[model samples]
Target: MDHYAFTLVNGVFEDKVRTDPNNRKPPTLIRQPQLGLKSYFDGTSNPCDKNIPQPWDRLRDYVDVLNRESNEGAKYKVIFVLRHGYSLHNYIEKGVKKVNEAGEEVKNDWRKGLKFAYQKEVSLEALRGAGCEIPRVLEDHLREGDPNAAARVSLYDAALLPKEIALQIRGSEVTNNDAEGLGEQWLRWVAEDEFPLPGAIYTSPLRRCLETTKKVYGPVFAANPKKHKFQPIIMENLREKGNGDACNYRSTTKYILDKYPNYMPEPDFTESDEYEYQIQRAENGEPTESDEELEERMRKVLKDIFDDDKTSVVSLTTHSFSIGALTKVLGNARILDEGDITAFLVKAVPL
Candidate 1:
């Protein structure tokens, strides 16, 4: 696992271990099996060795386990914009390393592209297909470049499951199993110690977001909506940015209602159609949407979502790419990984 250390002078976070001259190693991560604890590195070539313990002297040598649990990351995020947890489709994509204005590494809320194996880190060569096919996109996405160009795998070729089901890794078929341990992440980020109760929830109509809505916050809202001012609403525009089969295709409202009876759909919202034109274009290798068009629609969607409610706090469930659009609309945000929730406070700049 990747060990991390933080410089906290008097219980306040300062900088990551590698970035600080005083610390040599990060603190060790902690886990519990009864709670179904699992790390993002669970299925990779190398994962956390739970038997190991961090001695006080060597605390820095261990990965910073307390960081994720302390609600420290929560202080920065107020408007919770959550990405669905790991999915079968994320295999080819990796994390995007980013630096903030201060030039320090800004850890993604979801820790995308995180590799946990200590010395036995999974190598690209090891991930080669049975047919000796190098996962070119996965390779490029991990290695670093313009992500949009390098991070694509045809849904058909990837042999991925439906977008809504929890991703299974290796041979584990557990649904919403949080293969990357995102459930634990959600628990930390949304708990009272971290974020405030949401006033509303706006979700993508796709199965993954829908499933996430149930898995992540269902307990809080389902038990008592009035107390939290939480109401889950489905919006067609919240789906990923595409007119293609993947973005356009979705489960019927009846199917969703059957699964999550409490979810409320936008009025006048009806069935969805997989755009035949877009699908055909995709089949023939056409881009889903131009940057200009995508941004325009995203801005429109953001307008509707903001106009829908004036709640001080709200939770939004959507996909990765769309989250970029959200970042554009909301000042600035870190790149999101699956099942990652980024909460931030917002102030309206009246137009």
Candidate 2:
């Protein structure tokens, strides 16, 4: 399937905020000049320039027209893709310290508390049996008589830190049209009508993505109970590209379903990590999932959505790498920052 991306604030449309050399930042709703200026499909025929009272209404009508006129084999879908809020893994990866809610520095750095990570449910005993070298941090924890210290250090399928949860709360406010002074709010731009509600919602089964999706859409679901009868569908393919990183490795289906009992899992969803990490590289090469594999997984997921869903508007909550691969599969290029939201007008061409 091919796609065309437009009207993007953080994705393709670059601006001073995103390009500032002194303090480069992601395109956030709180940032000024949100959503960019009203753009036109053609240079002359701006939809908002028409007699339409609301810019969003004009844009919606334009999209409706495009879908209404397109051939049956080629249908346009407005995919609202959002990268999940920063996870603990992200915090560790950046190796930056920030004051947390407790006013204490959140972990000195990734190396401070983290020596290495183990796949979900993999115990220190198992790793030791596999001849994995125990990190000093883990050894210190174990020496302290803490049995669960390895689990804490591993942080398998990382969860969002408190700051990221706060970020999601702010992001949700914008989604619910609660931004009063945060500059141009895209959801508010369609104040004449409720911004097009996502007909279907999908999310990575990873804990952080699921948590972020819930946090961001909690109000939306509450406001439009009829539109969102169920929680977002958990999709394995929406998971981040695997490089043998514990954070990229998702939890088991049982674990996820236990947390999100109402969320739908695809029929083929496996109870355990379908793609487990290969500890012995000699036999299986590197455990990392290649970019080509990631793109193919993305393509398969897109095809599944297009085939099963009739909704024109769909929403996805996933990781940065997953979103990047998805865009690549759709013939666009975007590497969304953590917690950033962007949309793409994708046309699924039956191949």
Candidate 3:
């Protein structure tokens, strides 16, 4: 599979070939983004999952300063856990891996994700809105493209960046869509059922998470200017676990600030902390933290935040490793969708 890139060209989004990963040359035709989030990532183990951990169990993981309050001082604080929207890397990952209906790893049907991805979930509105033209040679991969495979018209933003753009092209496997139902489900809970508006958001310092934050909640915050736009704090701990190229790569601070001016970056934020993350992954070629280490970190981050934060509701956006790790500590695992947002109602007992 070719490593194609999507970039903004004079306010329009364009797709072109990017054969190498480490190439630092400036893009010739478009304003190539320095962020890895802008590029499609390569292969991985398995790629499709959309379920989440049970809310109550996750809530129970919250702790009190001491159990001295007769168990009444311990409980959960309301929170939302979400995954990043689909990415070019995700397109690459899902384009190759294969899983069963239950979303379990089946085999190396690597070619499956490729076909499905090329045949990205189709809708006329999305296609017509795609601002750029699809070359005839590339049209063979698309069902909607003309016979000559020459969708040779100018591809536009609306089409290139579809509202459903967050979702990966799944063809018949709309189960990902079913799993992604949390977006609407969360809205229904908030609007009709009267759920609390998010007080703040803490997300992985990845481009996709930031993008997802805007797409999923931007409209709500836009309507209510008083909340200061619920600026998401870029929490480093929330990034996906790994020392590999995919996990460690990040857009520069200038890049991120330019792309998302509204987001509140941590005072100490940096672009790529590859050295630090490599330290986290291992030392002297030996594995660093086992399950216990990850659990400890997960516990510490969640507990410290709950104790310090007075807000009624918060949200965390990051990758599956972090999500699944927390799920295992709390209970079992449910593969959450790329853009899914699931809520948990937690009440902290007074210390």
The numbered model that scores best in lDDT is 2
TM-score of 2: 0.68
Residues 1-351, model 1: lDDT tens digits: 111111111111111111223342222112222111122222212233446442211222122332233333311112567776555345432222211222223322222223211111234443332112333443454445564543333332122233333232322533333523544544553452333456678888777788777667866554555557445798877777663434335677887788778889988778644433343333333445664565565566655645566554567888766776655554442345456555433333224
Report the Cα RMSD per candidate. 16.5, 8.5, 17.1
Model 3 stretches with alpha carbons more than 4 Å out: 1-75, 99-168, 175-188, 274-291, 346-351
Top candidate on TM-score is 2
Which digits, one per residue and each the tens of the lDDT, describe model 3 over residues 26-92?
A: 2211112221111221111221121314222222222122222325445344456777755544543
Model 3: residue 157 alpha-carbon error in angstroms? 21
> CA lDDT of 243 in candidate 3?
35
Residue pairs in collision within model 2: none
lDDT of every model, 2 decimals: 0.46, 0.59, 0.46
Q: Order of candidates by lDDT, top first?
A: 2, 1, 3
**Local lDDT at 351 for model 2:** 54
Model 2: residue 116 alpha-carbon error in angstroms: 0.6
Q: Which residue window of length 10 is worst by lDDT in model 1?
A: 8-17
Candidate 3: C-alpha RMSD to true structure equals 17.1
Taking all chains together, each candidate's TM-score versus the true structure is 0.52, 0.68, 0.56
